[model samples]
Target: MFYFLKQRFSHLAIPEKNAKRIGMFRTLCAIFGGLCVAYLGMTLLLFILPVSPGESLVIPLLFNTLAWALASLWIVLAPTRLRALWRSVLPTLCFAVLIVFFFFKESM
Candidate 1:
């Protein structure tokens, strides 16, 4: 069955056992990373740059959308998909930690 698939749809086929196993993992990670990039990109921009409230809210929204698109593109184009996943995952984790830390700190 899969052999027929490989023959007919080589581009979509799982090239190897490892890639087959990791495909789902990579896909999920890419999705999560894209979301994280959008959120983190916006937060980082607001945290680091001086964007006043008087300005249109669309600025950050546009950046957030662009960030997600770039992250998704990077994941798809990367030579080593696992490495790409980790690269985004690390930053996502870092942003999550920072967000949590600040949330707690403010409450204290």
Candidate 2:
């Protein structure tokens, strides 16, 4: 099943390098990291701002969708840069999660 999907979307597959498994891991990390960053940013913003549940849900949904699109494009077009961006963004996301976890404990 996974192989079929990979064959169908072969353009998005990482190039055959010295370590194909490592390349695939890096690609997955970038896509997931981008999603995590977007979600964390929006989740924190939701807690800090005055927003209805419906509005809050929509905001994060849109951000995650956008991130997914960008991540897919990065995987197809610029795999190398994606790894660097993931590294830079992941820390910010972790910090955001910590802030939300600590400060918004009561509100959530």
Report the lDDT tens digits of candidate 1 across residue range 3-76. Answer: 98567554443343454354664566667778887788677555445566446456777898788887876765
Q: Show how many residue pairs clash in every candidate, following the order shown.
A: 0, 0
Per-model lDDT: 0.66, 0.60
Model 1, residue 62: what's the lDDT?
A: 81
What value does the lDDT take at residue 96 in candidate 2?
81
Error of 1 at 1 (Å): 36
Where in model 2 is the C-alpha error above 4 Å? 1-22, 71-89, 92-95, 98-102, 105-108
Q: Candidate 2 lDDT, tens digit per residue, 1-108?
A: 998877745643444455334465456666666566656666666665676757777776677778666655554344454444556466566758676685768566
Q: Which candidate tops lDDT?
A: 1
| TM-score of every candidate relative to the true structure | 0.58, 0.48
Model 2 has a clash total of 0
lDDT of 1 at 48: 45
Model 1: residues with Cα > 4 Å off, grouped in runs:
1-22, 54-56, 96-108
Model 2 sits at a Cα RMSD from the real structure of 9.4
